[model samples]
Target: PPGFVSLVGAGPGDAGLLTRRGAERLRTADVVLYDALVDPAVLALAPSAHRFHVGKRAGRPSVSQRAIERLLVRAARAGKRVVRLKCGDPFVFGRGGEEALALAAAGVPFEVVPGVSSAVAAPALAGIPVTHRGTSAAFAVVAGHAEASYGPVLDGLAPGTLSLVVLMGVGERAGIAARLRARGWAAETPAALVLGASGELVHTWRGRLADLPGLALPPDRTHLPGTLVVGAVAALSLRSPHSTEAQPAARADARPT
Candidate 1:
């Protein structure tokens, strides 16, 4: 019997946000591999399945990408229904493409089940829209871990005209801000950092672009999974007019493990 693989997105941190398709795959999975940031609640859905945690966090030892891919291939070759569950959308910075390619090359039958991405979901959950009429007509989603790749894109953006959503940028907040400023983005541009989006530990910090580096850092200086939103729309949060008044703090659940 030919084995199959399913790459499923678990959504940001909220188990409730997982798609029906993703849940279905989990229920039937013979083996499940999930990311570090995926909520435990979601993992519990595949109670009877063999589970592996292959998630990566900055400054922490993690299962290598190659190892994970190999494991997927091996599991599928064993005629098991393997599920690679990732936080947020599988294709959106989840490295699902690489896994899919590996599966294809290994002749393993596979499918991808998309889930809501933190890029848009994080900001929206923080009450800020990535795009709003007369505020931002376009938005750019960039991986902060690869800022060098965005140099040309950043340089071409017309600052206030385009909203910027940065993922995996909490640690590089200062550099990202400096780079944006160097690219002619205003220091006073509205910016918001949404940490642990859609989870019990969700915390929001809203301020100008100049405040990003400081606001993104907690007193402990530990990096948390966060999404940075910068532009005119970042200032238009529906949560509270006082959202910017609180200094960023780390919640027990939001701390990177």
Candidate 2:
């Protein structure tokens, strides 16, 4: 019999945040295909399943999206209930659709389970809300990776248009900021890098689009995932605990017309 599969969302980075359904699904999965961003404790939930790590990081040589799909097909063909566990909501830049399409083409049965996205959770962990009244309304979740290698994913961003929450953007930090500036974004626009998202280990670096690259960007940690916020809403950290009031101001999402 062709085994079934479930694309489970692992949430931002906190294992405790995993939904009851997500945890249950992991515990019962015959094989678990997880990403680098999944929390270790969540892996413990799948104690019995064979765990496979699919690399999808910034600069490091990670697994190709196509190869991951092939692996899922291979495992399912062997009659294994494979769990395609990914970080954050599978639909939001999780590449869940690509994997799902692969399964469908192979005549595999599958289900999708959603979870909290790092785009939102990371800012909250650092005391920065992506949305607030009298401040900002709309937001964008961008991919900083230019490609499978280290680059930038524009996602059609505009200057002072929307607050951008960039995932996996730490590696291409300089390039990302450069791109934003090239696209009419103000150099003084407030930008932030929130490392480890919701994990116990977290660091928030605040800066502007032009100065972001100089703010302790560690190239060795390319593969390590982090979230980047670019806009006035992201700068709310100054008012909150993420930073002191001395932080520089960035261009607000909605400025005086």
lDDT leader: 1
After superposing candidate 1, which stretches have Cα over 4 Å from the reference? Answer: 220-223, 240-257
Clashing pairs in model 1, backbone N/Cα/C closer than 3 A: 36-55
Q: Each model's TM-score, in the order given? A: 0.89, 0.82
lDDT, each prediction? 0.84, 0.77
Clashes of each: 1, 3
TM-score, candidate 2, is 0.82
For model 1, how does the per-residue alpha-carbon lDDT over 175-226 read when each residue is reduced to its tens digit? 8888889988989999998877776556778899998766635553344588
Tens digits of per-residue lDDT for model 2, 50-116: 9989957545788889999999998988999899999988997888999999999998889998898
Query: Distance (Å) between predicted and true CA of 230, model 2?
Result: 0.8
| Deviation (Å) of 148 in candidate 2 | 11
